[model samples]
Target: MDAPVRFDTKVALVVRADLAVWQKLNVAAFLATGIAAAAPDALGEAYVDGAGRRYGRMLGQPMLIFTADRDQLRAVRDAALERGLTLVPYVAAMFTTGHDAANRAAFQAEDPDTPDLVGLALRGPKKAVDKTVKGLALHG
Candidate 1:
């Protein structure tokens, strides 16, 4: 069999630092979910206990967290895109605003105005990710 698939690089989940505590948690969870959805293999398999309890954990790759505001977030997004890095963006309206309203606005709106990005998860070569997120401070 081929060697087990491994994520040999670092992953990052960056969030807006100015958000409320609840919003920070929400953004973190959503950002991680986006990464998990996009790169399931980066996560390890689930575990089972003798009692048939199940637990799951992320494996191989370790994630680094960072904090940034709206302008910084936009800059990172643009830089990542320009560098051809893979990014999963979490929008503020989707989590802070009501879901139905956010969805309707997103789908029904005709204008191309950009939504507010609350968080982002990026996975790729270590150098590329680092370059894309350079100068960003860690989340407090």
Candidate 2:
């Protein structure tokens, strides 16, 4: 049997609990992209089947997804930031924008101190990430 793998860093996504099912999925997908971009090392080697068909790579480590209320989402963002960890946020405005530029503009317009965050993605040291997400339940 293959030995277990461990990661020193952790990736997490926290989505607004009040969002619709579709919205939750959208937020998760978008935020995951940000994590992948920020941490290239997070990705694992591509796969090949028995017939030699190749498949795209995926995260080397498991990503934990958590659901939180609007207030909790803000708190989580703040906590991560306070720890000097980088955060990739998806504001409510991004949903209405179609392109990357518009999405960025919408993000810039929000209050930096308290954004209307629908979701957030973060990658950092395991302990820091764990402390940042403490008390949060896993998303189903």
Candidate 3:
């Protein structure tokens, strides 16, 4: 079997039946960055080359993944979860509330679980990813 061409992680492919969930939701994508300057030894050169791209690719969108070790995942998740409270809402508030506005509808319907799922969605299909970068820049 091949290592699947996952949008962000292995979990996403299973959760998404078609690509519609990803298309409809505004996701905040996050990847697991290995230890940073705070722990230079752990976040050494190897970690930088591999994990940095993974981390940077998903950070601005609406999802999170544990691509690295447990420690790195915990640190990233803790910081991100804290940041997410403010960050997620701010991103959601960007959409205009109108009948034709699917984005707004999704945003309005967000619960904690959905928002996290949305974050994953944002990290999806190449086009959605392009939009996520643009959206984050617009709001950030």
| CA-lDDT, candidates in order | 0.76, 0.93, 0.29
Clashing pairs in 1: none
User: How well does each candidate superpose onto the true structure, as a TM-score?
Assistant: 0.78, 0.96, 0.21
**Best-performing candidate as measured by lDDT:** 2
Worst 10 contiguous positions by lDDT, candidate 2? 78-87
Model 1, global lDDT: 0.76
Candidate 3 whole-model C-alpha lDDT, 0 to 1? 0.29
Per-residue CA lDDT of model 1 for 34-130, tens digit only, reads: 6777787777778888999998766446678899988888888887778777787777656635665674475344232454777888888888888
Tell me the spans in candidate 3 whose CA falls farther than 4 Å from its real position. Answer: 1-78, 84-100, 113-140
Off by over 4 Å in 2: none
**What is the Cα root-mean-square deviation between model 2 and the actual structure?**
0.9
Q: For candidate 1, what is the total of clashing residue pairs?
A: 0
Model 3 scores a TM of: 0.21
Candidate 3's residue-wise lDDT over 4-30, tens digit each? Answer: 443431111101112244333332222
In order of lDDT, best first, we have 2, 1, 3
TM-score order of candidates, top first: 2, 1, 3
